[model samples]
Target chain A: MSVLYSCSHLDSPHSPLPPTYPSSSSSYHQLDKLYFCEECDAVRCDQCVAVEIASYFCPNCLFDVPSANVRADKNRCARSCFSCPTCESSLSIQASDVPTESGQPGPPYSLICSGCRWSSKEVGWSFEKPTGIALQLQKMNHQTEIVQSEFDSLKEHLESYISLSTPAPSAPSSIRSTRDPSRQISHLTQMAQKALHRDVGGMVAYSARSKGRSTGKEGEKEKYGWDELGVYEAKGSWRAGGESVLDGVDILRDLEDSGAGGMAEVGKRWGKSWDNSKMTKDVLPQRIPLQTKLTKRCPHPNCRHLLIQPDTKSIRMKIKMVAANYLPLVEIGRRRRRIPSNDMNEASEQPTTEELERRRRERRRTRGGIPIKEEDESMGLPLKRGETYLFQLALTNPLYDPIQIRLTQPHAAKDVNTWCNVSIPTQHFTINALKDAWAYDEEEEEGNDDFLIGGSEAGFSEEGTTTTGGGSGMGTLGKKSRLSILGGQGTKKGRDRETGVEKRSNTSKVILLVEVLPDNNTGDRVRFDLEVRYTYKSDEMATPTEPGEGSGNGEKRGKKEEYKNFTFWIRIDLGVVE
Target chain B: MGAFDPIATYEKGTYIETDTGNKVSRKATITGATNIILGGKSIIQTGSILRGDLRRSTAGQHVVITMGRYCLIGEGAIVRPPGKMYKGSFTFYPLRISDFVQIGPNSIIEAASIGSGVEIGKNCIIGKFVIIKDLAVILPDTVLPEGTVVPSMSVWSGNPGKLVDTLPETYQEAMEAKCKSYYQRFRAT
Candidate 1:
């Protein structure tokens, strides 16, 4: 199941060490999830890519939340977007039948869930306008106001304590004590000026300090207790009179007795309202949370290229460097059993009626077995010991240039049983150049004739036999051999017929003969790794350098078509053995 | 054939082109065609069932399945309007499918609204009353539960689909081009 090929033993030009550190497990991922870093020439998965937020927008309203306003809105939708207290579905604005005094049909709006039929009217909530429901709800709720005022008073009380706890200011003998009336007079003048300027906050602080200092008895100069700060209560406070905590406890106990049916979920309670109301009936509708877009970058510190740069408003990536675009798309399918000619021998030998009946039962049993009998069947076929299965391994070249592919099984340890021996009939094959669909069709027709003639002749005679055939007439002989090779092409045609695979548009398919050994002890599933080495001309490496900068002008002028070979490994998990 | 992949090739003339430039597969089962408003150049692939007969119970002419331009209803995909009990009566809601929304093969979409540039991959089941905002992608085999709200620029996947990733800003342009090209590539030869 390992989709990515990561090996420490492989020779890399970039890595300093041998990469023998405790590496992660085989990183398996889909093609879309993987990114290719061109700078590092490596594949990076989601686990390896560094992600950053691109933009934020409300999930329900789909309104783009500005980063500046995001904190103020507490990362929730500011518009008339509310989830149902029951089903959590987005609530739609429904207009009530009741009209205004003008009789203009200016009806009040109530939030309603189209899916669950849950309406805000059930909670006795209604809005004059369809939009700005959150703002209206905040103003209408008295419980929130009480909490806000209490929080403000507590913050104010803590502010005084924080300011007084700071180290005393270094005195220049000016404010050594109250005995220095000159310093005290200057301080009073500064406070008077602050008051004239209408700096109420500063004036109040000065007055409080003066009061604390004047009320202080002997030997209690610096010891200003909390009582002297005075009780800073919220204006029009009703919380103390009502005993809100005890009331809340009683309400919670009543809800608990009524069962969990009317209780809000933990996620629903924490979503928007900080009020920990246990009952779903008391739970206010929450604005949907905003979701953020992510921009992915290469995790490699030195090669931090933009792997995926997502646009905020669209489903497209501004810059997408998927590994599928750079690497060959390899697919394994079209499995067929290489059945031996045992049926021919059975046909020649006349069987008795009892034996024929037994054979019929055996055939029926085989048909009902786990390993399905079909040539075109693909995937999850049981692999039996001492049985050979022929599969089509197709390699599609992503590059425009025709690539030469070499596929082989990775060398396994001696202790590990070679459960399956996969042999590529055609080890080295050149894939066609990538082109348009029409161009491919035209090229294919012409290439077929050439391939048939050339392949047959090549298969028929050895290199030594061609040379010995003669000097001037060699071309004619080769052509004649090809023409005759078509019919008398012998075992080659049969082999070609048995391994029916083709290539198209930079895609080459070869028959992979997987012969299971007699001693396959790897249990139900047969797993193996394949090493594919492909050679392609790297035109990108030849960046035009300044003429005669380092090398001679002659060498610089010539185009350097460097053919590089890259090797990668992929693990194939062939399903259950019979 | 030299290098042709026979298994990969589709049958020629499988799709029947209408006068409005819509390449609708002849095999597709489209009911109540009069009620289905297909904007120009939209493709309805083979075996796709568009339930246009499911209209609102209210006594009025309603367009049950209204698709925008360049939208592709993939092979075998079912596009139906979501229905629910409203005011003591079950009523099928009108489905609004915006432009450049490509629904993959075998997906069942019972959504209220599918916004522009949205791609629902193969074998996805978009549940009833689902509202998918613009530029969203529902990955293959995702099963979104009922009443799921998919936001704009988000990627949703898995059963009871959760928002996994967000679409990039350039997605609209890319989807438009992709739909256009896919339409052009589908030849009736």
Candidate 2:
């Protein structure tokens, strides 16, 4: 079972969020990817955290580009690292095969894509030296110079009205750049302004008169006429080479002549060189776009603690407040489907795969968004309706000291139409403390293997094997198996080990029996939430003063020890009934 | 289906377990054992090839393949030192593979250095001098070009392998867990 923990941001920690809201799945994430804020005592996901770039580096060259140079280089590599325009793979520099008169080897070098064997010679770009190709391209590329000047002129033209005008009310709308990217050199200032979330100096500005915009008559213009600020007269050079329409016609004709093979994909047209490279031949090798290491902070305005601060030189994180260290790693696996008995429900008959598919299609028509894992049995097969299946809900305690876990099913949302019968047989269990890797190996030799493979027969504390009932008596009761510090090794294996429970190292695997109820409709969703509150001794807390807030079934601890209670919710989607 | 269901099982004499916990399959093609260094708990699976004979030309007993702990060379994978022409002579470079590196089945790796937690998926052709940094994933059937530099956290895929995505920050922990579990599961039964 693929599990996702709920990050109930709005809900109070005391109140468990009822799994009713549509798109609640969006708030769920894998425990490992989630962050923990110590102050808030809540889980923080990627969506909730604030992100800032830690460092910029070239993916191709692996060069750590300084932040200053990132802006100057337009967030792309300034070095000789370029990706092939055709295949989008990094290019390698190759020297000219034909030697000069002196036969002194390399002088004229060209970038070539080893994947596609596409050479820079296609674009007639041959550099004298191989080292600094981007620098050389800056001097040689006259087209970009013209484009940059044009962008500057357009920005300068718009800056006039913006300087003289009042503040605009509707400022959140993206400021559209003047250039279409059909030409070279996209306006970097607009991009930079957008990145910084700064208000762009623009033409449309609200005045005192426009503040009372409701007073204006329908289909009538304002007296100031801010809409028609100025006419952009085309520059002389642009007007002189105003053959763009004819050029488009020529490109269309070329497309007709060469077919679809001549065209470039939309993804290839953007990135380093944001150009109208419709044709494969028009695409030029661009400097590889830079990648950034992000520094994430807790999004809470008050508690802006560093969640992740990646080091510039190393892959290590300077400050990582990951939830994995603080919370129990919950994994639902070991799915065992019960064999359908003849006397029970065989007379009622089961729905075939085709019937289920058709009903699923009908359900899809009504609700098109909720994604269900269909047909891919790599992770798990679909849970069949009217059949009882056994699952192991394994909780791995990350703490050095052993943890007591209490599992309870949260009351389902109002809709009982699409629900299942979930029976968590063993409500409470204790996982052994996480020790060094070698400690487990030594412990195994000492014969602590009975707990690793649980016994399904009867409860035996001395054997370290508790809980007897399996799927036969799924929801027998809320049985609390108090497994005290498992002392000196018990050598014997579980006499008759079954599928109900298993434990290894710091992980405790308990049986979770789920009976998929038909509830009239088969294709609708049947998911349930499990409330897991783990109590672990807090090493840093002052013990004598703090009362370990008596949660239900509180086990008395040593006077010097303090217990910390943490509660989290997990939603398990028992796949559609077959 | 489950951890209880062993990920892999073999005959009693299928693998020869080294003192450092390195398990080398008897069927694996290993050359010049003296030049090869397998860090503790590594597994060289059946039919996999490790070329330790292809050491540096100027060396006297040079270590060729220096693999770190919990490394898995999958079935049919070939790992050899990267070779280059230097000063009118062809010489080999030592292949350094760090901890928790899982080279999947049928992958041919001629990379110079593979950092810790790097996983190369099945049928990948990792070309010569490819410097894969920590926590990078080379997806299955990927063909990385020669001298390609794969930085940390990036996932490379497709024929001409490009940075398709990135790994989560907790990938190192996950990789370590996976490697350890796989090592535990792989045993002589």
DockQ top scorer = 2
lDDT of 2 at A159: 87
Number of backbone collisions per candidate: 6, 0
Which TM-score value belongs to model 1? 0.63
For A1-578, candidate 2 gives per-residue lDDT tens digits of 46778776633453344555666777788888899877666788888899999999999888999999899898899999999888888899988877777664476899998788999999999999989999999999987787787778888988886653433553553233222341112223333333565534422322222443556644223433443347776454544654589878988899999899888877777642435447888888888889999999888787798999999999999988898888888877666665543433443456554554454344335333543222212234656665556676778888888788899876554233335556675787777678776776654444333533342224344454433433222123332211212222121213321323345556767777666665436565557788888887765543332222235333335565757777888887756555
The best candidate by lDDT is: 2
Residue lDDT tens for model 1, A443-524: 4343433333322324434321221221113224443342333223222332343333354335667777675654556465
- lDDT of all the models against the reference? 0.65, 0.72
Candidate 1 residue runs with Cα over 4 Å from true position: A1-26, A99-107, A142-264, A269-276, A340-376, A381-387, A411-421, A436-501, A515-525, A541-558, A576-578, B1-149, B152-189
- Any residue pairs clashing in model 2, and if so which? none
Q: Report the CA-based lDDT of candidate 2 relative to the real structure.
A: 0.72
| TM-score of chain B taken alone, candidate 2 | 0.96
What is candidate 1's TM-score for chain B alone? Answer: 0.92
Considering only chain A, what is the TM-score of each predicted structure? 0.61, 0.73
